[model samples]
Target: MKKILLAVLVLLTFIGTSCDKVDDLLTFYINQEETITIESTFPIGVVTPLSPIPVKTNSSETFKNNKTRAELVKDVSLNKLTLTIADPADENFDFLRSIEIYLSNDKGEETRIAYLDEVPKGVKAIELKSTNAKLDKYIKGETYTVKTRAAIAKPITRDVAIKAAMRFKVTADPI
Candidate 1:
């Protein structure tokens, strides 16, 4: 009887230890890096006020359900965000005085994720990197909208097309 009891305790201990190791492995696998890119066009010939420039992402319609944004992006972190101007390079590009980027959720709440003011002359790209920015607040399956407000140094009579692209580096646990 003593041997049997000892064997049972040992088995329980082994199982507990194995379970903890498995949990750790799962966590390591879930925390991974993903890149999301969005592209759009904005007319910047004139001094345009902060406008809602709709940007599309990889959100899938099939993934939409009753799941909340927090549930979808639980334990996720946004590592970096980059904005690039594809067109109007060098002399062709106008001087951008200020720019602001915002993310809108399903409930229509807009959250500012990035901002740049007094941008350097001839700069075509801007990058925002922070460890504290949590992008999980935006829904996964829903088509979250990205709004942008840009100010140019001068105004023109004709519309000058300014192409913009956004890239997001996110690390999150697998759902």
Candidate 2:
């Protein structure tokens, strides 16, 4: 009986250590790039939803590079989201007040993934706070949508083109 208990304990220890190693090996990052355009006549001080951008995840390549598949993907979350003015060399984020970004798929369900309430002035680039929401279903799908809502603090004379960079942390099981 003593020998049987010792064998079980050893097996449990090995399983725990192996699970940890598998988790570390299967974790990786996926990045998506998008663009948002704001016309010069946009309304200020009121939250407005911008056009939803269609996204083809192309995550299969990333999964292949990481040695995992979508079926093995377990958890996904926004790690970092950055926005920068890509056009009009002299423009900055000073004209912005607040912005929120959401993620959705064909199911029509939407969830906020990143946002910023107080935007700093005189900067060409800004990083929004991540919501850290679980995003397994969204990332696993072949396509999804990025929806943005923003409220401007001031008016702009020319249309602004902003580039968005979204980085997501993906955890998957070893195949």
Candidate 3:
């Protein structure tokens, strides 16, 4: 009985690892980068929601390059999202106590994709935690909207521009 159990466990392990390898072969990444600005006169000590910014997706081109179409896509999720202060040469995220970034489609379907709580000070760039939400439709679409809600830590005298970089992991079936 012991030998039988050990053999079964070993077989299951091999099958699990093999499945992962197959998935890896079908996986690819698509990166999207955009710049957003926080106005200098923006108020402090409030959780404010920013206006939704529309973004055109490059998924069609990326899909073609990967030899896959939107219909063949099996799953899409955010791999990573990073925020960096782009303007003012020497500025950081010190003014932002926390921030949540949302993605919405044309039909108004929305989901939280990434966020950073208790943002570190004196740093030029920070990576936000992914909500692990499935993003297939949003990425497959031609355009989507990005909205942000942030807890401001301090007042800003000048507009602070931030570059938001997002990488998405996509798995699809071969055509």
TM-score top scorer: 3
What lDDT tens digits, residue by residue, belong to model 2 across residues 1-175? 9999999999999999999887878888888899998889999999999889999998888888888889988899999999999988899999899999999999987889999999999999999999999988888888999999999999999999999999999999765
Model 1, range 1-175, lDDT digits (tens) per residue? 9999999999999999997675444331112122222223335444344445454444333223212223444433344555555543333334566666667766777776666665666555556533345565563434566666666665444443444444443333335
Output the lDDT of residue 41, model 3: 74
**In terms of TM-score, which candidate is stronger, 1 or 2?**
2
lDDT-based ranking: 2, 3, 1
lDDT of each: 0.50, 0.92, 0.91
Model 1: per-residue Cα lDDT at residue 82: 55
Candidate order by decreasing TM-score:
3, 2, 1
- In order, what is each prediction's RMSD in angstroms? 9.1, 3.7, 1.6
Model 3, position 105, has a per-residue lDDT of 95
| Model 1 regions lying over 4 Å from their true place | 1-50, 60-72, 75-78, 89-94, 128-132, 156-158
Instruction: Return the clash pairs for model 1, or none.
Output: none
Predicted structure 1, TM vs. truth: 0.53
TM-scores of the candidates in the order shown: 0.53, 0.87, 0.92
